[model samples]
Target: MPVRHFDFFTAERRLVHTNPISLLKDTRLGIEGNHWLRKLLQNHVKEPAVVAMGGIPLGLRAAIERELDLLK
Candidate 1:
């Protein structure tokens, strides 16, 4: 099931005094799927000095910088 659906089910279950489904330890990666990539990008953008020095194309780099500024 999708995360949103599972979240709804969990909330409903709590209201009914029932336990929510347990998170699967073994399938964590399959479920989360590299959530760290967003953090990695955010970290890179947070450091403007390093962003200016990276070898990415000027246009794409500018776009990323703009998005980072908005995120702040």
Candidate 2:
């Protein structure tokens, strides 16, 4: 899965392509309640390419964690 890393705080806000699984885990652990991250996930949901690559962005990761917590 291809993951794109984006830094909104930067002047250019360039995207850095990376591996999706590692990126998702890092974002899930590092960032919390970030609207930009959430927006990125939502935008990806509409496109088949993003979803096809097993894209589980911050929002989905959070949701999965929440579900696991509830199950516990």
Candidate 3:
């Protein structure tokens, strides 16, 4: 058996090639960011004062409540 020398750097003084990859995106993580924005607008709908004061189109209150369905 013969021993070989290994050099960690090139003449340019940069790292020699050793590939290490990263995962930048994945499908399962989408909803980990998905819901909060919608929840913000729905917040106003949950408040009785805002709803009574005409929470936008008025019909939106019912829709938001249906979506929340918290007890179930």
**Number of the predicted model whose TM-score against the real structure is largest:** 1
Residue-level lDDT of model 3, residues 13-40, one tens digit each, is 7656554323323423332223433554
Query: Model 2, 26-50: lDDT tens per residue?
Result: 3445334465446645654354555
Distance from true location, Cα of 34 in model 3, Å: 9.5
Most lDDT-accurate candidate? 2
The models' CA-based lDDT, in order, is 0.48, 0.50, 0.45
1-72 per-residue lDDT for model 1 (tens digits): 324455467687785453333443344323333433343455554555555787543354665567546534
In candidate 3 the C-alpha lDDT for residue 21 amounts to: 27
What TM-score should be assigned to candidate 1?
Answer: 0.25
Which residue window of length 10 is worst by lDDT in model 3? 2-11
Comparing 1 and 3 on TM-score, the stronger one: 1
